[model samples]
Structures are given as structure tokens and as C-alpha cells.
Target: MSTLLLLCNQKTVSDTLTDVLRSVGHTVIVAEDVFSLRTKTAKEDPDAVIIDLPYVDALFEDIKRMSPRLPVLCWMQES
Candidate 1:
């Protein structure tokens, strides 16, 4: 099973995604914001990351710097 870090502030979304991923036999870590996401990424060493936020270019760059081979999935919310 792969470990995925989900960076999302919305409780409902985070909870749903976590449940789905876990049901599929994947491990998931949820981070409520960029700071915690970064910290968790470094600490957990997840296989991939899913981000739902605005202005995520810098975060993507930072993740690449931390783990170049890491896969990232980004979703933007409608304002």
C-alpha cells in the first residue's frame, strides 16, 4: 500500500478522502494547511501527495525539492 499525504483544510473533504483511500488499502495522512503539510511530508515520507488549495505553485516546488520522485495531485476549489 502506498502512503498519501492529503493537504486539505475542509474537514468533510479530508474525512471522505481519507476513508476512500483507506478502504482501498492505501495509507493517508491529512494536513490542514501548507505548514503542516510540509512538515508531514518531510516526516512521513509518503509515496504521493494530494493538495487542494489556492496558490500552490510554491508548495509544489517545495515538495519537489524535498522528494523529487514524489507524485503530486492538485485540485483547485471554486471561489
Candidate 2:
């Protein structure tokens, strides 16, 4: 399995995802923000990223500014 990076500010969500991925035998890394995402990418070079997109509209510019495109899994919190 490939390495997956889960980027989410919600600790429970990210931690749960990590547990599931690891259970399936994929290595997982969790990052809480764009900065941590970059830092983890530098170290781990994951094959994919999962992010919560609740505020992605505000983050679009920054995401686009990133050098390379990464596969992303998007989610939102329900109220």
C-alpha cells in the first residue's frame, strides 16, 4: 500500500483516518495545516493526501500556489 497523508484540523477525524489506513497496511501521516503538510511532504513524500474542505474556498489560492499537484481526498464537517 502507498503512504497517505491526512491533513485535517479536527484531531479525531485525522486520527481515525490514520488508524483505518494503518489497519489496511498503508503507512499514514497526519498534518493539521498547510505548514505541517509541507513539512511532512518534505520528509515522507506521501503518495496521497486527504483534507477537510470546509474552508477550502479560502485555501484555494494557497493550494494552487503549491508547486506540484497531489491527489487529494476532500471532506466536510456536518453541523
Best by TM-score: 1
TM for every model, in the order presented, reads 0.91, 0.75
Which lDDT tens digits does candidate 1 get at residues 1-79?
9999998768888899999999999999889788999999999999999998786788999999999999999888786
Q: Global lDDT of each model? A: 0.91, 0.73
Looking at candidate 2, the ten consecutive residues that score lowest on lDDT are 58-67
Backbone clash pairs for candidate 2 read none
- Top lDDT hit: 1
Off by over 4 Å in 1: none
lDDT of 2 by residue, 1-79 (tens): 9998777878887788889889999998888777887677667777877778577554544543552576666678886
